[model samples]
Target: MPENPTTEPTPGLENLLHETRSFPPDPRFAEQANAQAGLYDEAKADRLAFWERQARELVSWRTPFTETLDWSGAPVARWFADGTLNAAYNAVDRHVEAGHGDRVALHFEGEPGDTRTVTYADLQREVSRAANALAALGVTTGDRVVIYLPMLVESVVAMLACARLGAAHSVVFGGFSADALRSRIADAGATLVITADGGYRRGAPSALKPAVDEALEPRNGAEPTTVAHVLVVRRTGQDVAWTEGRDVWWHEALEAADVQHDPVWVEAEHPLFILYTSGTTGKPKGILHTTGGYLTQTAYTHRNVFDLKAETDVYWCTADIGWVTGHSYVVYGPLLNGATQVIYEGTPDSPHQGRWWEIVEKYKVSILYTAPTAIRTFMKWGEEIPDRFDLSSLRVLGSVGESINPEAWMWYRRVIGGGTAPIVDTWWQTETGAIMVSPLPGVTAAKPGSAQVPLPGIAAEVVDDEAHPVPDGGGGYLVLSEPWPSMLRGIWGDLERFKDTYWSRFPGIYFAGDGAKKDEDGDIWLLGRVDDVMNVSGHRLSTTEIESALVSHEYVAEAAVVGAADDTTGQAVVAFVILIGEFADRAADDAGADAVQTALRNHVARQIGAIAKPRKILVVPELPKTRSGKIMRRLLRDVAENRAVGDATTLADSSVMTLIASGLAKPSTSSED
Candidate 1:
């Protein structure tokens, strides 16, 4: 007998969980995915068979042989038994052979008003030139190269060039400071660094080559392996310090190098790239991935999840290639499926809040994948902005980063997606190579904020500290029990850290670092980072809980809370809020401030518990954020804790941080702290 025998069942949830969002894939979409998954599953299910199947998926040689995963060598595991396949040929040749050479491969929109549409033929020529130029610089197969440049057509050119030479490319975010760039360059032992003169940011052209020069400067008086030649593309006309022997222009080199070169054939599990990810602790871990299996999974998932029509639809992912969202959507996944995508070089709010809407209207983008933080920002800008433009072409919308709050999710569903398009509230990490769990648009029942369920081959569960499954209606650490395609091979240069950080949390299980609750209806609700959970007066409190409570108030526009030091209790909650226009009246006067603060505190007390009330509330103008719209909570915490700030390099504007710091120094009169 179930404990809920007396209560009614949560209706429609079962339909919500297992239904395929791809109700009717483009006939061939499901057929291709099903066939691919069948081959992929068979290949991986039995280690030996998996490699054989992966080879079969590729244009393989007449030779195939013994050996599976070579983990015994550590950090140097080889796959594909003893077989060979070319990455560039697979990404280019096979599609061309299938009569897609004339199809538009890249519909590129540059920062300026100019546009360039690169067909498969044009892309092939450019890639051949870049590969030969790289060879001239002594970049051979197995060499690591660091790419730190703006979002331009050249970014794709560089990636393909590296693939052609069988070199591992680590693309550091262009916005990252020299220190961040230095860390990745050193970690990968990259001998070559490719940069650009500069690229656009929020509609303005800025110099990036200078940062590359500074980043490559000899460090700590030690001989540098990376003080090598810096290949710069002249994107912006900014004056640059040109070095004769070490700095070479992209145009000059590409002009001289022969435009005919063959891609190197390597084993499947050979290292592809190392993308560094910083967790809550600020320690960056380099995540590694490979060739054959990665492309296979990305291609299969992209086809099924979006039911992509490569020829008809114009797809655009608003994320920069610096982040994992960009890696999967912008670089690997979409391209592997050979879809037409718009690559914007500016922010959603650049020039004005209407920028994103205008792009979608002009390009008629069929699908848009973005972060939840971006949705909330658009919500902050008001719906009238998006309502001004046409968005009917959109069939699918994607959400990444932290789980979206309910109200914002609804706004995204209605306004940006025009209510009819399905939202894939995707859940994956920098560590996970691609979208691990998300709703397939055709088969999945649309949920406002929920990610829905795991992809067909993924196995996820909610487990407690002891690795036991939690009861229904309970929250626990999100974990994966089985290896899925596109899972990180390991943290670069540190397999032990990989085992200790993720695998060790729950032996033989991959810990997601996020806290999740399986509701009574068996639907998983991601609760942000497990570390986001706080202990206030012996009662467990989620920061999202308080933030959500505060946002629920009509006067509140946005809210962020951080636990601070408290002698009486373990920690005290401090909240920073940006008020809506209606709330402006309250922010202007002492009386209004007191009323709004008290009301918000009372609301949280009622919603959660008395102990969960924020001890201090600081009303502010705006939260410091990245270009992509994620709040810089680390900086906000620095303000709350009254500590010297850390790494203000990536903040949208350091002044916003200065504003926050000054405001936080003086406490609000309504505060209990």
Candidate 2:
């Protein structure tokens, strides 16, 4: 690779950060990997043919697809349109029929020390029973069901059961408020709701049924909900007020239903599921994904990207089933690949700080996938906690959800991966349905904090405002040049909004709504969301870049940067950071806090440039993050701009904002620029 280039500022975005470190694939792992260099060449030779081959090989289609793609619909593509398949059958029943019935499918671990081991055959029976039960409740094909349950094996069963009946399932995160749940239920026009009495969190039972009851109640003379029945799982055995005829016990219904129901075969274009995008303020856009294409891509990515050896490897993705990551990776992808995975139902720190590593050690997990926020939290808790466990079973590490900082990437590689395991930092969205851009662990040399090149059969590029491709060492908006098999069909019931939001930005291309830059090596590095980009004195700076620089400092553990309103500069950089465990005590006093803040500001200036340095730095004990482990920078912007903190109900811990706001009331460590 050429040396990092020094160029003038570009029109789209100013390229600032430079990374030279790269780790090539280990020869031994590469030799036996599922994906090889030829994979890319094969895709390049004929993209549609490559995807067709993948569909034919990875998925078990009830009726084979003769057609690969039909772009006659433009933005809303029809992939494998004429094919027929059952997602639940492909994920569960097919594996059982192939004599893998005894293979473990799920290893469920509850926060309160409860455990359940389920096999492929067991999953098939459970799904069949649930499908029968749902059918008895008048949930037929094309009906929508809302699932608001904790991360339990039952949650997985519910989703697969819905798929088995050809009914679309929309899983709302358990952490969401009643209003959020009601909005989604109303939008989807769901007929049935599946929830739990409560689930254990932080070593205690957290009631979930109340939220469901609240959501079902008509508020402000609103029309009665379309919901006909509520299926409640007795997780915590808590007393829940029930509407006698409307609410039914999950176990009782399943026990009465026969376990011989057949899977419903539907066209490839049948809606598989609808997942609403998180962190949205008003009405949420429901991203609709179809069966054949979604299953094909997710299965292919799961097998190759993680170098998954289904028979030998134990994979675990630490995501709740409510989010897209949980839907795609935790439930669909891994299960479709016939891979055994661990599913945990609690926060990382419940019971103890070492709960996650303990589960990893117990399960002998070979592949671990998680978000950078969790990794940074583990960093704050100190490495000694993880060091206490035996992590040698871990072979590959994966990062998702958002752009990871280079420092967090390094820490994850060194401490968690045991220095040699490959890390695949995947980049994709709910709209994409599956992984799009990610380094093939066995083919490309890994670069810290960079997603690298697009995956085989995926066409992505960094382009300027004119939709022209940026140079190798330039920064611009990221766009997908061609439609992929797993691309979302459209936002449910809102075709025009879908076109305006994603397609209107770049004609004939899918704008990812993210800013990105290419290194001199032509590797792509995500620069956070374009909405988070700051304009400082006419220079556009990525909050991700500045946060990366801050985390690069030895004393800083995690950081969130926001652009505050400025009279002269238009926008000024303001940062809130959490210190490492050892350095956390230093921020107790004003002098130490000032010294630490100044040092981070100076480090950012040296790392990127003076223009990227933060104007003010606040040493926060914790950053507000959502349940999915994404930092809530909008809340920080409120604090930075001296406005009242916005609605923090969605945060994992609303008290975090209060602590940060109180800390800001004290003396701030402003840079003397």
Candidate 3:
């Protein structure tokens, strides 16, 4: 009867794609959009000018960029060809020098009830101390160091210190196994390791130093390990086996170092970090981003995309420092812009599902950016959880990690964002280094399921398998037409692998890995990976579409879909649905759940088509996700095909396998069919 009773759209929202979309046109926002418009124009006309303008946006030296981009060397691409600037200075000193020192840079709340307010000045000192400590460890420009710490101050410190010395840092998620850490360490050939003795996890101390120790076990030769020293912070004072002359305590080492280390100026192309990305190689691919150019784009995007006003805004990107979202948004993006932000070291539902809402209320966070998986988790907990705390200060919300299903997207827009804040459905990857295709808050009209339009300077196109542009409403591969300032340099050790993996996908174009469909208005809707698209009865269907169909079912909590081989059709879609707890408990006995399961199958057929319906629907307890909220569909596919799974090392809970395995090989039937 009532038209769904949805919240009214965000005020002053501009439609970057639809020329006819109306807006109130605020002067300040218009002026900014105008200036940003110039950069986009320059980028399209004279590429060099585009990059030079990007550098000028941030604090820089007397001399400006002499050259913009150089890719004459096949694999290694250089950005801001000949420029000098310091990442630490750009992030810390410049903000402090600009009289924003009193502004809170990091509202860091530890998992163990400890709080630290790090202002710009304080951050400068901490970064300097860390820099001096790192320098004393013989770290210099171009040196690569492995950071294996938990979500504590030292993780941020290690990143800043590496930038200060012009050294590249690789931060492996603390949840990763020693073998995973060891692969990254050896690949980077890092001379130093940074970690904590132990860090708080769900109100308890968990050992991290031991993992680092086991990782370095392979290099126990007389000449000493490639990791010359391990800088361990005493988070829990847990007993750690001392490797005489190799293990250095943080308090003793860094506290003794000078707190006024000068920042080292670096070329625009000087490597800032080597973050690893997952792929078929089994060995992780290092996605390298440079200092000046990377931060230039990062700062610009944070300002315009989030409509951030540093002096007043309390921004919080609830991403662990392990992933690219943290590298761009959590630490570098906010700090570079001199914005007050919150960083917590726990899950959304640690002691209670209300943890995130409490943090937002406690810090009075205005802009909260998080993931779809988390939003869905909050949704599972329901409105009562958010109602427990005052989250009215929140003005902007963000989604990343994976495509947010329309249902979860609508739920997030209403519940977490309080119905008025703009949701920036950001889409990018570790290789991209920054947000590329996204809806700019307050500027772009909101789209529930679509990312809306490419950022002004980003040139994205949906191309068919043959590398030809696809028409409107046609699903195809996503590709970048040009390289931007923050594009990855190359794969760390193997340039050929980098070329083969990303570049070779479609020659001359940068492959985005994800499949996409552009609307008649040229707005992009991200489907999952190219490998994720399923061909059912010769009709192409995205796993995202099928999963979305499954989620639309009332009883389903979350769904993961994969294509499995069948003799009749090319492939059959296999779905795994995690039922809602109430329904799950009710259906604990076999016969009770069968009716709901049948309803789910018919739901998918009605939503898309009969051809898109899955041949099998497995009921699993939970879908595997990284510390960041990305589902490991690769592992799910392994489970679907009755194949032994690959790596479960990064999962937050290894016991989830027991839950998933228990459901496998059980007879399943589609409800409606």
Between which residue pairs do clashes occur in model 3? 598-671, 598-672
Write the residue-wise lDDT of candidate 3 on 298-326 in tens digits.
Answer: 98788878878787889998888889898
Candidate 1 lDDT at 535 equals 54
Per-residue lDDT tens digits for candidate 2, residues 1-673, read 0111123352222233335368989999899999999999999999999999999999998888899999998999999999999999999999999999999999999989999999999999999999999999999999999999999999999999999999999999999999999999999999999999999888889999999999999878787899999999999999999999999999999999998998999999999999998534558999999999999999999999999999999999998998889999999999999999999999999889999999999999999999999998898888999999999999999999999887888889999999998999999999999999999877899988899999999999988887888788787888999999889999999999889889998889999888888877888988788878777877777888888888878998888899988998889888888788677787777887777778888888877888887888888778899988988898999998889999999898999999988865233556457
Question: Which candidate number maximizes TM-score?
Answer: 2
lDDT, model 1: 0.73
- Stretches off by above 4 angstroms in model 2 are 1-20, 279-281, 664-672
Q: lDDT per residue, candidate 1, 470-504, as tens digits?
A: 77766667888766556788888888988888877
Lowest lDDT block of 10, candidate 2: 1-10
Assess the local accuracy of residue 646 in candidate 3 as a C-alpha lDDT between 0 and 100: 69
TM-score of each: 0.88, 0.97, 0.93
For model 1, what is the error of residue 468's alpha carbon versus the real structure, in angstroms, after optimal superposition? 0.7
